[model samples]
Target: MGGGIQWQQNPALCNIMQEPWEEPDIPDVEAPTPRRALTCLSDEDSQKIYDSVPRTEDVFNLHRGDLELHEKLGAGNFGSVMKGVFRRGGQLIPVAVKTLKQDELPNAESELMKEARLMANLQHRNIVRMIGVCRSDMIMLVLELAPLGPLNKYLKRACGRELTMNKVIEIMFQVAEGMAYLESKNFVHRDLAARNVLLVNEQFAKISDFGMSKALGLGNEYYKAESAGKWPLKWYAPECIYYFKFDSKSDVWSYGVTLWEATSYGAKPYRGLKGCQILELIENNRRLERPDQCPPGVFDIMLRCWRHDKNDRPSFRDIVELLRKFRSKS
Candidate 1:
């Protein structure tokens, strides 16, 4: 009557309806636990991650107390290089201690370590050597002392009266040799200039300041910088200025400017010209004129280095060979 199914009032139907429905048994199984995603790591966790990687053997750590800093040799915005004595193995050896200012330490430690690591791997008479590193209260790079100081300042102090054509050629040859070694190691000295080169004496020159240097990866011919800043525009090649590309060829271009500096007795390249004017000059295929003291043959080398086409530039190896012949003739 109510539109529902009715059971028959029979014995079998009534017995079946009177009985309750039974549920089938199901096996109980546990659900898998969810993994927590790590959005940030704690200091301890970060240290643990790096602890798995092996340390580089090139870094030789030294005790900070062992170094006695004396006179400040030079100072810059980030740090200073001071004359120091390093006591090791019962020997007191004179060294240059490079330290970052307290105010700049937060942002400059990585760069200082990078410079130390690069210098440690390099072993050449014409390349500055890293004695060791100190990471105690502050980061310090102990380096072999170049008593004569920067080549640019040394040249300016000499002022042409002390340096002869032969001496200048010899200095250039030594720098070329250092650059050749760097090239063989696949290292590019992005800041190759007279100011970056240091001298142990008038006859011996070593390339220093690897903060801007880069080691090219295997099979890579060039490195691309991520950002533009206060770069040495006058010493840079066209490709470097435009595309931020750097390679051995760019170093050659800087070397040409450095040669000009040496021949001109530390005269600034593109003097009095602003960065934009220098860029315009380069875009128009114009270059610095030859210095009065620079020989025609040496100036020819500079021209070859400043070729508009990077591929047309000579390799450090070729320049070294050419300089060798020139030195012999001089």
Candidate 2:
């Protein structure tokens, strides 16, 4: 206590000790905002997302009242094709309307929409053009009318009237050209039978019914069906019959069968054989023989298309070239 009293008596030492310490002030800084979490999609989820979006290609959406339904042209498992008039831009245009049967709507809508979308994108002289689509209480695809109707029916009628060989060849040549276009676009028309070919006039043929066409670009040379249905066993290739695999090569094989139908004047392929029998025949390395009056060169082309090994089958381009040469020779 006596020593501490000595420091209080010293003025300079007391002033230093009694001074209070001062601290510097700091400005506040804001914290950064947190980011939201991201989600990874599975393949199936990605496909569903893709399917929900509309294609960039122009597709007309129409109202139900715009179309006036007329006589039915044909009927199929999914729907009916009828001759109709579409009121467009103050003018009535004749069109073929494909209407979904109400009872099948729940199960068939996706397929119908897919077909409509595909047809809308395709624009070729030898491919049917979709005009517009009406998605009201039911789905209706308005398409350009092919006045002469399907090739199979036309062939039958022409046969009865004794049509010329050159005329028949001309029709098939157009089909080959259409197929070549499809090949160039990487589209595989799984159903390439005569019934699916439509005629704009008596001489011109267009490939239609793209419900089974598959666009290839995803490292797949073929499409394997996920489920079974009423497949055209007569027009299918050996591989298609056995493995359910379809590709441009399979369509070529079907084209050969369609040629058979044409040259034979719409005669049934494998006329007396059952579907199972036809499969067995093809499995045993047998193919449809030449039609009674088919030109040897034309039949040769058919043989090339019906090759047991799909790799051995000629491309549609080759088929078109050969057909042109054949036509020149004729």
lDDT of 2 by residue, 170-266 (tens): 8888899888888888888888988888866556677888877778877778878764355666787767755568889999999998988888887
Off by over 4 Å in 1: 1-59
TM-score of each predicted structure versus truth: 0.80, 0.79
lDDT of 1 by residue, 232-319 (tens): 6678887775666899999999999999888888777876665556665776778899888788889899999999788999999999
lDDT of each: 0.74, 0.72
C-alpha lDDT of residue 260 in model 1: 89
RMSD of 2: 31.3
